[model samples]
Target: MERLINIDNGGTLTDICVWDGEEFSFTKTLTTPFDLSQCLFDGMAKASTDIFGEEDLPRLLHSTRHIRYSTTQGTNALVERKGPQIGVLTDSPTLAEELRTGDASAELFDDLVGSRVAVIDADRDLEELSQDIVRQVNRLTTDGAARLVIAMADREKERTVKGVLLRKFPRHLLGSVPILFTWEFTPDAVRGRRVWSGIINSFLHPTMERFLYNAEHRLRDHKVKNPLLIYRNDGASSRVAKSVALKTYSSGPRGGLEGTKALSSAYGLEHVLMIDVGGTTTDVGSVKNSTISTDRRGSIRGVPVSFAMSNVHSSGVGGSSVIALRNGVITVGPESVGAAPGPACFGFGGKQATITDVNLLLGVLDPDTYLDGGFSLDAQRSRAVITEVIAGPLGISLEEALIRMEAAYFERMSTSFADDVVDAETTTVAAFGGAGPMSACGAARIAGVRRVLVPRMAAVFSAFGIGFSDIAQTYEANIAGLSANEFAATKTRLRERATRDMFQEGHEIGECRLEWSVVQEDAEGQLLSEDSYSESDPQPSASAHHAMLTLTARFELPHASIPQAEATEKSPAVSSSTRNVRSTAAQVDEVPVFDLDTQKAGAAGAGPAIVEGPYFTARVPQGWKFDVTVAGDLMLTDTIEN
Candidate 1:
């Protein structure tokens, strides 16, 4: 059987999903942030053992037709400020002026500068600017900046600066530091966003380069001939060497969005809200009319950039989120214990109380069956931490504190839903991620969502989503004149460039699918209107004129074939055991606990039940009933309403 492997390297866990023609196998291992490739191989090895009954790395790599990877490392590095120090060089004095006056743009500038970086102002004159660039490069490098970004406000100045820098410091030189040009990274009309994008990419370059290159070398060592495909925030995959670091921000959440789109289409749902609760964050996204929503000017950690990506809103509530009592109120995390120590239940020296610990305390998670018994939970350790940190501080019993903490966790999750997905005409809530199933019911109830669907592979759903992605490249060009002819000519040019680039990447022209769109902007460059056009459509008329036009061309290559499991009829539900789980209505009740794998399609059960899987546990509250679809999806609905 042909094999396809996909992996999502998250902040805490590195999840692997493998498709061996007829069946799917999924597993998770701890992420080694110091060397992500370690976890990548470890997870792959575990999946290999499950598939082939042996942990032979080279054989698995050689047999695999494709290996797709996604990671949260870029976002994590930016959030933690762990990347290399960078310096910015601009032709205008406005950056310095803004820094002095503390303008809105200056806030973003400050975010880029951080503590170890510096900014240098240069004059527009070619000669003077060239000298200034040299002086600043020397000064910044002396100050320990390993990377430099050039972001001139004026297009001519930017061109001159890039030319001067390249001529002065050729990349082949032994002492040459890596230099990046803002326009090369992004030519968006928004100067600040373009500059920030360049800076962010520069900061993430070294780490991404190291990890991705190391992974590729490891693949080579294992006799894997296919290029390592990296996931992008635009819901596509690209060769690792061709991918931009900035385009990978929020890529893990983007994979979830892609999977949600597929599920939405297969289940015939008009609108779906997807919530992915991982170890460190809960990402929420919406899909309408079978299309994932996208934002062209998406922001990372509140700093806007011009890269188009899936519109996913992330909150700091997850399974491993640190839970504590702050100022007489229960608080769930924006901070996480992550996988190193994990939750108190992991017994890896973690002392903090987390949502995972609360689930253990409430008897929702089966200690003996967690991770298919690969790892066992330390209930005593969980109890000790919760008793001291949460229960004692709140002057409540363990169960009461557990219930309150759960309420707080779900409240924060529900607020994110209300903020990002409530008004979107959502018909179903698709929950995935290691912690997603555990929190889905309560989050859905609080958000007034009536239907919830948890796929059989809910825990490794993002990695599963990566299995559906295509290899794609996007190109953009700014139209100089706002004429119909200009728009058409620009589109032609960009399409040609895109086709050429993809061809160089080894994709044939016939195998590529091209999509086109135009962005219209006013004199001030504020967005006026954006529309998609086809090759057969007439040129946009001059009467619908705009100050500037930006054209985008997307080239898509087909993805590998993924087997779709057929849905079967519902069967009578059976339980392996009973556990007392705290209901959303604030009552502890003994609920039937069903194993996800053992329960066949057509199996049906009611709320106030626990559905345990290898990686996640779904808590069905009092008012709900869950049925197993033939496709192996657990469909949970409000019993009274449905």
Candidate 2:
């Protein structure tokens, strides 16, 4: 094992974590939304500077064994409805109508493929069908269709229609809109899963493609030997070309889940509820027995998709999420200011009121020391925005508004945790991200969680989590019939495909640990059963069922050491300094701040205090005890008994 660097790109910040075979070091940079690659390289340069004490990109890149990346931008885009307008074309009218139907997808279907659907007749002559498709494409493009998805009844029909479109609208045609064939993604028999998967993938394609390929090309130019690996929602890393854009959804949160799994194993804890509060969303996930909650067929906004992924819910409320008084009710997000003009406190011309602004005004955040004082936070700007958007409208004092805003934010997070976590008493909440620790105690207490663990690397925790992923990929093919020849043929095809794909990932077929399985799904695409595939009898039961041959190839990598509690005797933690903070509407209190850097392992502290790290801070409010281990792990346990 050598240098493995993990990068988690958020809407507002890009976190970078470097593991040099032994110790871990990390840094972060404000995201450049205008050009994501800019922030990607910016963070890399900072990592290089932090490691070698100088900005040495070449030296850093050459020595690195692997660099894995994950991002929450796709999740943010889907939540904000910020992707390109999409159009859908299908051979079956039933499929086209179902695609536009707003039942399973709700308003998401209307926002993406609504009214932009076209149907073509498969029984028509080839020339006539081609003419119909061309007209539909023209009409859809004219109706502001930025992208297109071709959804048919099956792969056979889908591939046939794709050929017609490619012939008419050749790639050389610069004006031709980009198109996606749904069957190319998955062989799921359900039309809804196949079409929605294509639509979502097409929506996120441009962003992921532009950023990843550009970054990969630049890395190649710099003589970086390994291809850039993308961390997927399936708890593995694969090349950009091999990964699906829809799989990138909520992947950053999945990275946080991986880190939570590590912490659970190290600390010997069970049932961890994760609250990953990033800039735009507070992603909630759960871990039982060191395993993340997962769905065999994942859903996006409740619309089922054709991928198995971790069960993480993205709540709209976050640090930079717009907080306002709507209809006399405090509303938290669904929209965000993002990184460019983050929150009002960021002083990036953002006039929006957000939790960041509230925290700044309440003294929980030091304007001069936030982000390690890298950027100045404008307390006055925060105050002005809050007064205009929240206080003035509600006819309340700014101080009162701040207090209300804090309660609303914590309430939102607590509500999300309540939905995900069943036994709050047994489950320990693990909070991570730049804004995660600020009110972790308050949120957990509200949710009735008795404990919270804020990792030392909480600020860059997601990026650090990506280090646990192994290089892996899966290939599957639908079995045409239950006959022996057909099953053997499908098995041979998937095996050959897996071998070729893994070879591109820099591993030979023999070197990979391969697993073969057969999966059967009902007509509605619900998973029925799975059985290990044996070469002796590759055929499925003669009964009628839709089966698929799946082959998984993985290159297992070494994981970093699991954390162990330090041996030092626990004692009261010494205070580094004190900050004047507004704890209530009536008065300000002197809050003792514990700088973990100056404290020894096993040092303990109690409530009404702040545990401040270089990149993150946690509020140890009343009724909680905070402790640090030798490896810089921070744990907060509720002092209140059950």
lDDT of each: 0.79, 0.84
How high a TM-score does candidate 2 get? 0.92
- Residues 538-642, candidate 2: write the lDDT tens digits: 466634366777778898876786557547788889998898778787778898998887888889988888888868878887778988887777789888874
For candidate 1, lDDT tens digit of each residue in 126-214? 67766777777777777777788877776766778778878777777517478888887776767766777787898888878888999
- Model 2 bad stretches (over 4 Å): 80-85, 103-106, 124-147, 163-175, 391-397, 531-544, 565-568
- Candidate RMSDs in Å, in order, are 3.3, 2.7
| Clashing residue pair totals per candidate (backbone < 3 A) | 9, 0
